[model samples]
Target chain A: MAGLLLSPTEKVFILHGVQDDYRSDGRSNIDYRPMELETDVVSHASGSARLRLANTDILVGVKTEIDVPKPDKPDCGKLEFFVDCSANATPEFEGRGGEQLANSISNMMQKAYHSSQAFNLKQLCIFEGKQCWKLYIDILILECGGNLCDAVSLAVKAALFNTRIPFVKAALMDGGNIDLQLSDDPYDSKLLDVGSAPLLVTLCKIGDKCVVDPSAEEENCSVISLIVGLTGDRKYYYPKDADKQQSVESKCTTIGMNGPGSVAPKTLKDAINQGIVAAKSLDEALGQALLKERQQNIGIKKHSYGFLK
Target chain B: MPGPDLLSSQGLRLDGRRPNELRRIRCKLGVFTQPDGSAYLEQGNTKVLAAVYGPHQASKSKSTTEGVVVNCQYSMATFSTGERKNRPRGDRKSQEMSLHLRQALTAAIKTELYPRSQIDIYVEVLQADGGAYCAGVNAASLALIDAGIPLRAYACACSASMAWRNGEPEPLLDVGHVEEAAGGVVLTVASLPNTGSIALLEMSHRLHMDYFKVVLSRAMQGCRDIEIILDKAVRDHLAEGWTKQDVVTI
Candidate 1:
């Protein structure tokens, strides 16, 4: 942020490029920067991933702990997101400089993942209203390229997919106290079903068009952008013999067009449509990549090239 | 020491390293295109990335007519260790590290060459196992070279821990987290290995004055070895002509 400065003419040039469906880096409007993702990079975390999206580098580690379920949501668990923007990215981000950006990103992610349709908290529950698993998703921003939301969400999704929760053996007492035992073998764990987890996609509205995954230059050119959080298929669960009836379309499975931006109704509509298409394709590609990585892990053919290696 | 069990009867320390062996160092220069200079270094499990910017106009109050202002900042990742840290910088420990880094780097940099300018060197520890300070120094040195900064020498840092073996004091080079946590006296030295002059030296815990010479010399030797490895890496990086920017400049 400190060293990356663009002249007025350069900003205009980038804006014009976005309007013409081309980016400064020769990428299309919806094209993402070349990215590399690796999972299980940190041995200490329950789940870990490192993602490099162009110059932006992000690492996410998910730790699991036991806690009592909330009385209102007795059957569900809890999730907390913390983002640490390290000074390594830039000297300007030293001290508490990046705190505002980090807070904003973390807040946006929390809102995106708030709805039950985005994640199934029931899977994290260990006992009904007694004990539950709480997930601490810690995100470390190593470097800031541009479009931090998109990159962080993608890394978080990949890390969540890579997370393994140890299976708990529990016994219930007459007083309703549950005793739990976790497996000693590290490999003996349960993988989360994060297929429906949402991934944030930022659409930077340049001259007259919107570009996905804008570079730093492109970001400096734009005035405002819309963040869209799109999820894959989500299955609704109900208790046995419940009187209520629900349908898939009734839940409104998508959340789009967020952030501080004002747009024409027509352009907003177009952006939403574009966002849905982009999210679907992105989700599919992410799924394929994650599945391939998981297969490689199973075959012992993958080596985690973390920062050290 | 636990009465000197750092080295076992089988002649192996924790993490399976000999008394004088250093951790494997893998490094890459010019990892990023944004910074004027960038380098990534990994010492065993600890990983550090350093980026250099400037020789440009100095910020207000920092400019001096005599020489360039060499500014440095050191930070660590929240999830870099077993326990998650709440904050990465602005802490007392990080401030001390920043000061230490500035002292060592200022000694190596030819500040008089660029008058009334500022150079910013930033080191970020992505993963911290042990010897993070040493890794930061080495990585920043590479970054300075990549940025074409004139330096007296390649500034190298290494830590030596003293433990009694066979009733004789032995200093372990490049101590890892396990060894460091064992609570032995650790002497960290940053120096110009060729000149054999110390840039910065810090000691934590206590050591007898009689044994200080041995421990300090051992740390200096480790720095010399690191310089050899880093020199080879720089040469290999340059030989490959992997720096595409050179083509544009040419």
Candidate 2:
């Protein structure tokens, strides 16, 4: 993350604004920036989507390929996430400048989607252990506004929803080799079940309240922030805190925060409560948007308005 | 080669196009509001977006007294090709493509006009079916024009492949992914069509020296054809108040 500089007076101005539940940018504490999303933008990829939230631009493409599953996880499939921070975003990302940030974001996404509850990999399996469909979720970071993790997660989820894996016809054994038959019909494909996919929500603690999506200027005012990944149901949060003692039979935890700043115990509770409420709305909005795009007839007749006209 | 089955007995190549015919090219300028200039181009199934950032103050180390430094970066989307690529830009192939992009654009840009300055042209290939380098160059030219940069002429690039048809050597124009994978000799030419001066020419497979003239001329003809299409697009783009919807109206 590039550190933004703000004067103490400026910080106080933002802090005062957050304390009242109103942000410097006219957004409420839990309100997000105005977002523009488009799907089926790239014709070459199996599925693609571009999302712009304020200054943050994220382009996600999902490519499908056939590969043998891991020995231990033979019955499951694979999903790999690769994030590229191109120099087009900023001069700072030139050369190997953005590698650290890119790696951290990819790692966080890997952690969030690591659990089976968050993503069912078994659905991608084509055979018992010999073959499976591997999905390569490539995320391109065009611009980094403030909440990159949240924007990326949203775009990835949308891209996954747009993906269509070609139908596999049959697997026949000839002597010692296996021959796979694939259906040529473009419409004969399977759509991934992404309802349970996790969406990341970044909460910046400004003053005593937490804000969902912070601008670059607002980010400078806060010392620490929390990145919480939640599904639509909000039934659980992955990577439970090891410090917190819990019973094995208990339900999943609902809060995840990361920050260097300390908050009052009451403020922490309030922030967690707000985070839950915000996550639910975000998921619902995302789900509806994806569903609408899916319902629409997406075909060659629909002119692809990529960055071009 | 897929043998005699690729080219039909009617002399039509795969996808039902004549040897000298090019894929449909559609382009738009000034697509993004943030960059100084930006353009998007689709060569058949291949889609590319290019953005121009500057001609502003050059970096301290890169500043030159005689001419402006032209910096280019070419990156393909991970899912652009049939198989997903692990990285977008840092790889050796992308680095080489960036160099080739600079070579073509530099020939067209009037670098000496803006000394001690730098121009950043970034090209992103959203979908690559083949001829990615040519598409990148063509898109960058449009973006440079949209940025209002001083240029000598439109930098046009096209590719040609040689095939034996009925005992006669036939040259294909604007080779697509299918033709490129046929393992025939491919000749790529980037030129200033009006000046008839070539900036860069590369050949992937070896062909007889006697056939070079025909193949090169065919690629040059492709460049001329592309220039016409691009010129029409620019004119139509300007006539439509430079809006995306208006450009795509046709």
Cα displacement (Å) at residue B215, model 1: 1.5
Shift in Å, residue A40, candidate 2: 2.8
Top candidate on DockQ is 1
Kindly give the stretch of ten consecutive residues in candidate 1 chain A with the minimal lDDT sum: A233-242
Give stretches of model 1 more than 4 Å off. A1-25, A169-181, A233-261, A299-301, A307-309, B244-250
**Shift of residue B75 alpha carbon in model 2, Å:** 1.9
Worst 10 residues of 2 chain A by lDDT: A245-254
Which 10-residue window in model 1 chain B sums to the lowest lDDT? B241-250
- For model 2, the DockQ equals 0.37
Residues A1-309 of candidate 2 have per-residue lDDT tens digits of 464567899889889989898778888899999888888887767888999887778899988888899999998999988898866676567677888888888888887787787788999998877889888888988766789988999999889888899888887988756678988887899887776787888889887778988887887788778777766442222123423633232111234555577777887767666776776777778776766665575554665566653
Error of 1 at B68 (Å): 2.2
Question: Compared with the true structure, what per-residue lDDT tens digits does model 1 show for residues B114-202?
Answer: 88899999898877988999999999999899888999999999999987778878888998888888888889999999788999999
Evaluated with TM-score, which candidate comes out highest? 1
User: What is the Å distance of residue B185 in model 1 from its true position?
Assistant: 1.4
DockQ of each: 0.40, 0.37
lDDT for each candidate structure: 0.82, 0.82
